[model samples]
Structure formats: structure tokens, C-alpha cells
Target: MGRVLSVNAREFEEWMQRSLAACEAALDGFVPIDAPVGLGVAMRYAVLDGGKRLRPLLVLATCEAVDGDREAAMRAACAVELIHAYSLVHDDMPCMDDDVLRRGKPTVHVQFGEAQAMLAGDAMQALAFDVLTPDSGVAPALQARLCALLARSAGHAGMAGGQAIDLASVGLSLDEATLRDMHRRKTGVLLQASVMMGAACAETPARATAALAEYGAALGLAFQVVDDILDVTQDSEVLGKTAGKDQDANKPTYVSLMGLEPARALAQELRCQAQQALADSGLPNTAWLSMLADMVVERDN
Candidate 1:
């Protein structure tokens, strides 16, 4: 087994930059520009190039941690990103959050009309599965597994269900447990799926898989906690989205339930749990996962 090696921030940053570039190229190549006029353009606009690409990065990182197939991991990374982009498109519509900004630019609904934006989201979701269940490359069994993973994570029991709870909880005071549950479904499940999907692409041991799942859960929760903190502390320019919108909308968040300092502490605690889980995993090389846990907490955006 390859032993875990300590990687400095600069080294990891360079690796991440390169991985992101490869992921971007794959996305560009996978998401086609068809002749549907506005719909095709809107789909491209929604998915082509934007956002932090955190889900894809998680997929790639977890795959690397497990010594998974690089090609499968790359496809998994791009597939998860497509689902995320679709979610953002629908989430920013006038019927939902009604936001005008995303990834430091106009949301799809704002750039394209609401109708085209909806269609774009719908098409991108279909394309996500298409990218996963390709005619060749990945095995059919793995394709089925990946499809199931992506669907469950993005569907009602995961992101969609969480979003529903979020809409229902606006202006209502929620306790910490309820808030965490909501975030787990809304944000955490998909992140967890990213890690799990990566492991599925490889021959990871059951014990190590369980440990990675735990790490993904902790890291996902930490990610949301940090996002809650950033919403309170950062500006629109820095955050790429409208800052303080959660507060303005009276959405119950980590910072809203606990103070900023406590919320920050909660994020750190989760990060530590993630690192501990990685350490528990018998997989020799967990350095990437550990570094990613830190990045989840330290990220400003």
C-alpha cells in the first residue's frame, strides 16, 4: 500500500488547479451545444464554466484516496457537477430563491428567460445520467450504480427534499438538530454521494468505504457550516452570490441558531471529525482527504 504523504498547501493547490482544469475540459466536451437555440444556449450557460466545482473535486479527491480508476473518476466528477449546475439553475428561479446572482455572474434564469432556464435545468439533469451511462468506457454495472447514486443524492430524499424543508422553514425558528437535518439533506447528501461514488469506482474495502462515508458526512456538514458563516461575514463580490440573503430571507442557518463564533467552532469540530474518520480508514493514502477537509473549513467562498 502507498503510505500517506504530507502535502503542503502550495502543492495541494497546484494539484487542485490542474484537476480543475481537466474537469473543466471534460465538462465542456461532455455538455454539447445543440441546435435548440435558447435551450441549448441556456444549458451551456448553466453548466459550461462556473461555481466552485466542489462536488466534482470531492469526487476526484475521494477516488484518488482510494486508488480508483481515473477515467471513471473523471466522468463521475463531471456528472456530479452537471447535477449541481442544474440544481442551481432551478434554485435561482423566481419561484424559488429568486436570486439574481450566482458564481459572480447572472443566474441562468436572469440571463435566459425563466422558461428556458427551467428547460436548461431539465436537460442538464438528463445529460448527467447520459454522461454516467455511456455506451462504452465504464462497465454497465458501474454505470447503473453511479446512476443510482447520483439520482438518489439529487432527488427528493436528498437535495430536493432539503430544499423543500428550507423553503418551509423560512422565517421560522428552528433548533440546531432540525437545522442540521435540513442541511444534511439539502447540502450534505450530495457531498456524501460524491465520496461514495468515487469509492464505488474502485475496489475499496468495506471497512474503508464505511470510514470514507463517515468522513464525507462530516466534511459535508462542515461545508454547510462554513457556508453559513461566510454568508454572514463576506460580501457579494467575495462570495459570488448575494451576501446576507439567508439573513434577509430569515432562513434558519447555523449562524442563525448559534452565534458566529460558535458556528465557526462547529465547522472546525466537523473538520476534525472528518480528519479522524480518514485516519481510521485503513487506506494508506488519506492525505488528500485530510487536506480537503481543511479546505472545506478554510474556504472563503
Candidate 2:
């Protein structure tokens, strides 16, 4: 039902590069450089540079797809990214995953003490909402919608809930259905919310909104499936994080539950579902969304 464009790989790459640059610049400006006791420094370190910025890209792509407000989309993009960064900061703490490296650099806890890292995460989580509710340009109604979408995705019902399940499931053997539910909450909801928040920036048809929701859900799960695959097949230097850590922690991942080849197949299947959802969205320009789905499944890192 959608209008398909003749987009090639080169064009998609150029668009991705431009989008990523804009996101990085916006994040650099939005994340503060000053807070009491060097808190700002740690926050900036955790958010400013590194990582794929997939969530922001999804927000921007969906905004463009919906012909939404660019200003609102940018703010939503940054807000979702801030929440993701905060989660990573907390997840890498000594009591959590106890990771030393993230994004190919020492984790916030490693570089800045544990207390500072924890505080940095807390600040970033609060800052995400602050970014959403700006004084001007964005409408109050849109602000509230964006805030609500973000809060639901990051709160107990979404990412935090998933994390709790992850922590508890460590060393426990979770079946495929249970693992899917956990990842759907922990990793998938926020990504899905990114798409929804972007769509919220403007008025969209109910049909398109529903289709995009399906697209986001499929794409989010595909991303995590790829992550599980990369964890075992790739190395620390390649992954920018400790490789095999999931296995080391005995965490139940798609790769663990379904086997590596089957996990890879599932990622491909999910990518197909995401593309089909976009096709069903009936939007004129969803080339970026289509390409991003491919990127998520095919990405090496």
C-alpha cells in the first residue's frame, strides 16, 4: 500500500551518515558540560560520543515518514537516546552487568567512580524529560505526548522491567517464550517507543500509526537478536563491549535458546516482518525505515 521509491544502497548510506552527524551534534549540545562535582563530565562522557545511535535514527526516520515537526522530532530523538545512555550506564555498574568497557571505551563507572557513574545515569534520565519539554517551538500537547511515550518505554513497564527480568534470569534457563517476553520489555519497547514518539510529533492516520508500531516492534526484536548473535561470534574489540559476557554470565539470549544459526534466521525473519510492516504503512517515503531495518539485521556490531 506504500509508495516505494527507487532507493539504492549508496543513497541510504549517505542519508544515514548525515542523520548520524546531526544526531551527534544535537546530543553534544543538549548534554551539559557543567554540573556540580563533575557530574556533567560523566554524563557527557556516557552520552556524547560512541554507540550506534539507532534509537535517534529511528525517531528521525519515522518523523520524516509521518511529515512531522522537525524540531519536535529532534528533541524526541535526543530524549530517547538519553534514556538509552542512562540505561547503559546503570547496566554496566558493578552490581549490574559489572562491565568494564562499552562502545570501545572504559565504562562510566570505570572512568569516573561508581558513585559518579550512577549519578550521571540518574541525571541523564531526568535530562531526557527536560529535553522533551522545551520552553518554545514545540507545542505543549506534543510535549506531553512525547513525554508520556518516553516514560512508558523507560519505566517499570518497559526497559526497567526488562532489566529486572534480565538480572533475575541470569544463570537461569528461560524458555523461548519467556526470553522473548523479557527482551520485548527490556530492549524492544524503547525502540518501539522511539517510532511512536516520532509519529506523535504530527497528526498521523490511525492505520499508518498501527503499521509503524508493528514495524518498530519487529525491528526492535531483530536488533536484539543480532546483538545476541554478535555476542558469541564477535570479539570484545569488534563489539566495543565484552564479548561472550552473556555466555559468561549464563544469561538466556536468543542465541542461547535457539542456537546461533537459528537466532540468525530469526533476525532475518524479523527484518522481513519489519519491511512488510512498512509496506503496509501506506506512507509515501519509507525508504529510510526499510533501509534501517536491513541495517539492524545486517550490522556486524
Candidate 3:
């Protein structure tokens, strides 16, 4: 059993600020401003100026861990964020979660009409791949690998498949195993793919890649568990989204299934698992990854 080393809080905060600034700039530069019919505005609205950019940070951090190519990692970071943003757009629509608020602002469908929001999501999804497959800088082979990883994670086998299960399972009793499976596809895969994509930016060894995958999976599940906890414990103003929506919708969550204290315990357990994976990875610089795992589980909103 491996252990998580202590991370300097001030150092982590400084790194986070720098990484976030870079990611925001990359996203703004990559997302176009000249699409026809006001589409560019909606696309930018959905992607820019909101959210924690956790996925992008994960991509960048893992890339640093492996000493990977900064250009490819940055592209991958922006691409993953695009996929995540697109998913949030569609997920908040009337046909889905029907959310009216996201990231403390009106949902995309509310800001833009539902039809426009739909198109924005569609365009962002396409643009994710476009960001990955630039005409220059990134090698063709590396581009292909990054695209394949993102596509599979965002496609039916990953996020979409998990969402399908989620919609159908609403108001239904889901055992722990079934619930885990649903979330693993819906949320975990993308987060895991972020790590793998970063690793792909350079020639990471097999052992390190495997360990990072394990770390990503554990951190992803831990993220959702903490989210469930926040839904019940935090309010909308604090959470920046609808609070208690899961319980209101009769959706099964870790908190609903296992009670609040147990769910909290589970989150800590998963965080430990993530830290253990990082320790096992044999990569020298995993301070950021370890701190991220802590941040995922300990986040207030």
C-alpha cells in the first residue's frame, strides 16, 4: 500500500492559477469567433468564462507528470474541456436534466434558445476534434491517438452510455454496482481519458500509464461522490447549480443510497485509492495529481 505525500498548499494554489490562466487563454484562442448565424457567440458562451476547468487541469497535470509535450497537452486540455462543455449544454436541455442554471448563470438553453443551444453543443463537439487534429505542430500519429481517446470517452461507450443508463434509472432502485457502472461511463471515463490523453502526449512507460489510469478512475468516482454530498449539504448559491436536484428528481446517488456519512467516507476512501495509485506510478513529479485528488474529494462546491 502506497501513501500520498504532503503537498504545499501555497505552491498548489500558485500552480493552479497559472494552469487555469493558460487553459482559459487556449480555449478562447481555439474556439472560433466567426461562425455563421451567431453560432460563434453561443459556442463561446457555453465554453468560455465559466466552470472550474478541472478536466483541463487534469490533462495538464498528468502531462507534466510524464514530462510530455506542452503543445499536445494544451490542445488535449482544451479539447477535453470542449467535450465537457458540450455535454453540460445538452444535459441541461429540457429533454435531459432540464436544468435552468449552470455555473451560477442561466443555462445555455436559457441564454440562447433551445435550438441554438443544441447547435452550439453540436458545434463544440465537432470543434473538440478539430482542436485535437491541428494541421501542424502535433504529429499525425499523436493526433489520432488523442482524437480516438476523446471520441470513445464522449461516445456511447462512455459518457453517452452512462447518461442513457442514468435517464432510464431515474426513480429506480440501483444497487451500488449498477450505480457505479453508470457513473463510470458517464463521468469517470472522460476524466480517466484526460489522464491517458496527457500520457499519450509523450512516451510514457506502461507501468506509469497503468498507474495513472487507476488514479484517474478513483479520482473520477470520488468527484461524483463529493458532488452528491454537496447537492444535499450545500445550497444553489454555494454550489453554483441546483442543489438537491438529485433527491428532488428521485435520482439514485451515493448519498441517497448509502446515507451522507457513509458517502463521505466513501469519497475519502476513493481519494486514498487515488493517492495510492499516484504513489505506485513511479513518476517523480505527481504532487499536482495528488493535490488534485484531494481537491476533488474535499471541494465544497
- What is candidate 3's lDDT per residue for 55-125, written digit by digit as tens? 99999999999999999999999999999999999999999999998999999999989999999999999
Model 2 scores worst on lDDT over the 10 consecutive residues at 1-10
> What is candidate 1's CA lDDT for residue 200?
93
Order the numbered candidates by lDDT, best leading: 3, 2, 1
Clashing pairs in 3: none
Better of 1 and 3 by TM-score: 3
Estimated TM-score for each candidate:
0.97, 0.98, 0.98
Which tens-of-lDDT digit does each residue in 108-178 have in candidate 1? 98898899899999999999998998788899989988999999999999999999999999999999899
Using lDDT as the measure, name the better of candidate 2 and candidate 3. Answer: 3
Candidate closest to the true structure, highest lDDT: 3
Looking at model 2, residue 260 earns an lDDT score of 91
What are the lDDT figures for the candidates, one per model? 0.90, 0.93, 0.94
Give the runs in model 2 whose Cα sits over 4 Å from its true position.
Answer: 1-3
